[model samples]
Target: MQVTTATEAALLTSREIITGEELGSVPLATPGAVAAAARRAAAAAPAWAARPAAERAAILSRAAELLLERDQEAMDLLVREGGSITGKAFYEVHAGAAELRHAAALATGPDSPHGPGSEPGRETEVSRVPLGVVGVIVPWNFPLLLGMRSVAPALALGNTVLLKPDPHTPLSGGRLFAEVLADAGLPEGVLEVVHGDADAGAALVQAPDVAMVSFTGSTEVGREIGATAGRLLKRVVLELGGQNAFVVLPDADIEQAASAGSWGSFLHQGQICMAARRHLVHQDVVEAYTETLARRAAALRIGDPYRTDAQIGPVIEHGALTRIAAAVEEAVAQGARLVTGGRMQGPFFPPTVLADVTPKMAVFHKEVFGPVAAITAFADDDEAIALANTSDYGLTAAVYTSDADRGRALAPRLRCGVVHVGDQTVNHDPALPFGGIGASGNASGFGGRAALDAFTRWHTLTTSSPARAYPF
Candidate 1:
């Protein structure tokens, strides 16, 4: 377990910098290379799960047309190894090439909208069956689009994967997904990449030939990988972490809720888990939305995430800028009110904006992430739904308000799972379903048909028309 390979450095300002590339302590896979890649994906998962789901949706629509013809080398390795910023690295390579063309249009067709005829002469079918190998454990914030939205719908539903990434961005998740699955031909052990970190993701989630693991990142290591994949009964897909809450509503539009809550709390600089780390506001336009969100978070443009007028970058390493400057110096030593930009400077922490934040501050109960923000000041509408349902995090929440009945009556009392009104819960759309709820972790990451029903697993063949022979 002594593999060592490091680099680190970051900066991006005081004499510009950027280094990253680390691997370090790597020894995990030699249980005969995880049993020969899980016995060659259990002997090619029953012939790629009996092929023809429109030929596995035409190889995930030619790997989303070779990932939009290699979108500027996948936004320059997601802005040089995921520190991302050139407009959030071209919105994570155009939302991972539109989540691989919406999982190749849900794998070319439809089989179960819970209908395939049953109970007449009986021939019930509710298809979707891959779940053979898939171990994916990505996360260094949008590292190659959430590891190609969890390895392109688990290789367009025929499953078989090992992925792992995030040892602080394993060279853009092992060289941009082995050069786009070798330019879309993809067959060599379906999809493999096993770099290491976090004990090689706990040896591929305690590898018992990995049946299913998905995972994204931190909800305290996704509750320890859902308690070690629920004691190895496997099948998990968590996409944890989010302190998300934006609110606003004193008939919001105070310059579009202060430019969408200062670009959803400093875009990637907040090291997003759906940024906008709690704002609340609305004591009748809390002093004009905190003076137009502290003049749009001090007119952003921090530095060097490959420019393009860098809307604040650089908080990837340096221990997330020293835990976001120690959660804004323990929320200004527990009195909160730094009102605008708390200074960090090296890993650029300026976009900060804490105003009287109190949920017994720890940047308002943890998950500050980076570009530190924390407002809080509600009056009406049930005290802005009791300060956005005081968090234990329910992921995405936002509600600027021009009164669409008070943003649909305070968006379901804001307990969160993905709410947005006038907009800025970091609006996403990898065909929808994103996740979060309580402690911000409970499996979900864009619903391209709910990620093929979380990488498949269901079987029920009941043919009863064989002249009803009853025998218990």
Candidate 2:
């Protein structure tokens, strides 16, 4: 097995790598190599699409079993390659395996809502068919889960896939997945893993034979891919960036709200797009809630990602750490006060809590992809709603209120795609639709059954008796 390194490129974290080996230099894939992989996928797509749904499902199920069997190895790779805590990696593997199982179940069941069904008199049938080839561009955060989320469904739907995992964590997850699928008896060229950077991603998206492109990354990159796919007239599913808000109401339990805020903001070192970035608290409970949150934030255990007791880990790389530090510094300079945990040690930035953060501060308005939480006090219900909806993002939001009426009422008013009451927004069930609106890229909805739909194209088959034939 030959491992080749492309030109050295700089990452947001200032970390560099060559052939999956980090050496304080950024790594990238050459345009020719990515294009070749795309071509290979395109060439093999039709044959893959011809495979029966049952066969596809069986193979995917085998892959799932393999993943479960190698759970520890997967978790370790996730932690080392993606910079996530051991617990988080465990959850990733579990969720990813579950996704594969669900997708397999869906494949063997029916042809979706559009599939053929029995009727008493009428001969009507609809079918769910593969859309040839799919290109999945995954992110560094939750690398294993997100990559599998897109790939498993696409493969289950009988579509060949060219998956380009995030360059930062490509070899660990991507190589493992490819090996598993191959060992599970999946047809060669049906599932391919390409390692590279943005040029590689662009090649996958622009490949003329690709039927759809599914991407999970920042909003800026999503826009670029969406525009390219639009020009090519190919379907696209994008899960982009988010600046989710966590609203703490006057009647909320201060302790519960504080705990949710701490976990929601610092989980995965706050690299999650759905992680609560803004903390909008009611004036009545603001002081107490802030105090509790600050105390909890400071107490978080940050160490190597492989440590079981480590609650927080490094921010992917040093460049990510730098960007997060700069965001906090700018926010403080603009008037926000850092309550605790703003300093950086290696790639780890201690869980940070910022108080008195007005909407004007960058930390309040932008997606600070780090373990930083910005707190602002709102005087009343209307003010809280306004503050929460002020951001350009509407991916996810949370409202903490004990009153049933208040919680229900506020839920509908939130501009986000998903909302949780009395809890910080972190719920991601494989059965429910998950995607966002506004600046969060336009995929409409995805996840669970919706994600399965994204991997297919519908075809209607209507028949009529000879006597009822239409006149030409």
lDDT of 1 at 232: 82
Candidate 1 per-residue C-alpha lDDT over 1-472 given as tens digits, one digit per residue, 9 for 90 to 100: 1243335422111112265443223333444465566667667777776777677767767877787788787776667656677777777777877777777677675755665563688777566678788888888778777888878877777777888777656655655776676677776677777765676677778878788888878898888988999998897878777888788877666998888888898888888788889888877778778878898888777777765567777776777787788878878999988878887887677898888787777777688777777888877878778777877888888888887776877788788788888889877777878888778877464576678778886766666667686688
Candidate 1: list runs displaced more than 4 Å. 1-24, 27-128, 135-137, 141-161, 169-193, 196-245, 251-269, 277-314, 318-339, 342-344, 347-351, 354-395, 400-407, 410-417, 420-452, 457-472
What is the C-alpha local distance difference test score of each model?
A: 0.75, 0.81
* Candidate 2: count of backbone clashes, pairs at least 3 residues apart or interchain: 5
Number of clashing residue pairs, candidate 1: 1
Q: Which candidate should be chosen as best, given TM-score against the real structure?
A: 2
Give Cα distance to truth, residue 51, candidate 2, Å: 2.5
